[model samples]
Target: MNIHLRLLLLAGAAIFFGYTLYYIRKKQLDLYHSIRWFVLSALILAMALFPELLTVLAHVAGIEIPSNLVFLIMIVYLMLTCLSLSASVSRQHARIRTLVQEAALMEKRICELERRIKASEENDDDIVAREAYKDKSR
Candidate 1:
């Protein structure tokens, strides 16, 4: 509602767009979904700057509203998007945990191999020493 808040929101929107574009170009972000997020972010930023835009649009679409319907719609969209993202994050986390478990098992196997090799070497040394002592006593 204030001038400073409006400017900050505008700056934030600019940064969001810039980041989205840079990420897209680098192939680090999803194309379709990122664009959807970008558009939603930009629209929300615009609406925040001038909330009357919502009223005007609603009126154009023959909707009478004294309440915050537009804000509710935006919130719902963000909620669904975030829910999907959270599910994806959860799946990735599960996969990473499985990979870590596998790596730990591999490391344990390597340690077991080293222990076996060392034990075999000690047994071989003991046999050689006993044979040498017998020959010396003869």
Candidate 2:
């Protein structure tokens, strides 16, 4: 890689690393999710510092172009990230459905209790009125 490009990659990797740490510290990014980002930035820093490493990796992987290897790695990383996110979304969806069902059940129980309370109050009023009527008749 050219000197300018390497320097750019180095700066980008450093910035990414810093941002990841910042987010983690702020609690915006959890350790589990930030791990991949840390690995990515580290890889970029490594490739920038030692351009020959990419060539060696590409050769070992039977890739003619080092850039192509980088592209492949990025693609695989994105695919895995998407898969993980999809799984997380699926779990959240299931949890939300369960929560909605439980909330509905609780609401139904509350309404039933309210109805019973109203009925009990009305029955007490009738008994009081009947006793007052008998006392007045006496």
Candidate 3:
């Protein structure tokens, strides 16, 4: 790579690394999510510092163009990230569904209890009124 490109990559990697750390410290990004960003930044820094490594990787992977290797790596990484995020979203959706079902069941139970309480109160009032009537008759 040219000197200008290398310098740009280095600066970009440094900025990305710093941004990742800042978000982690601020509690916006957790450790699990920050790991991928850290790795990505480190890889960029490595490639910028030693462009020869890319050539060697490309040769080993049987890719004629080193740039193509970079593209392939990025594509794979993005695919894995998307898969992980999708799985997480699915789990959250299931948990939310369970929570809604449980809430509905709880509401039903509460309504039933309230109805029973009202019926018991009415029965007690009738007994009290009947006793009062017998006492007056005596």
Decreasing lDDT order of the candidates:
2, 3, 1
After superposition, the stretches of candidate 1 with alpha carbons farther than 4 Å from their true spots are 1-12, 18-37, 42-69
* Residue 14 of model 3, lDDT score: 97
Put down candidate 2 lDDT per residue, 1-138, tens digits, no spaces: 568768987898999899999999999998998998999899888888998988899999999978777678778978998999999899999999999999999999999999999999999999999999999999
The sequence of per-residue lDDT tens digits that candidate 3 reaches over residues 13-122 is: 89989999999999999899899899989987987888799889999999997767767877897799899999989999999999999999999999999999999999
Candidate 3, superposed: residue stretches over 4 Å from native: 132-138
What's model 3's overall lDDT? 0.90
TM-score pick, better of 1 and 3: 3
Full-model lDDT for every candidate: 0.79, 0.90, 0.90
Candidate 1 structure quality by residue, lDDT tens digits, 7-122: 76577678878888889999999896687769876775876678677678777767676125565667788898899889989999999999999999999999999999999999
Per-residue error (Å), model 2, residue 123:
1.4
Q: What lDDT is reached at residue 76 by model 1?
A: 83
Q: Which stretches of candidate 2 lie over 4 Å from their true place?
A: none
What 10-residue stretch in candidate 2 is worst by lDDT?
1-10
For candidate 3, the C-alpha RMSD (Å) to the true structure equals 2.3
Better model by TM-score: candidate 1 vs candidate 2: 2
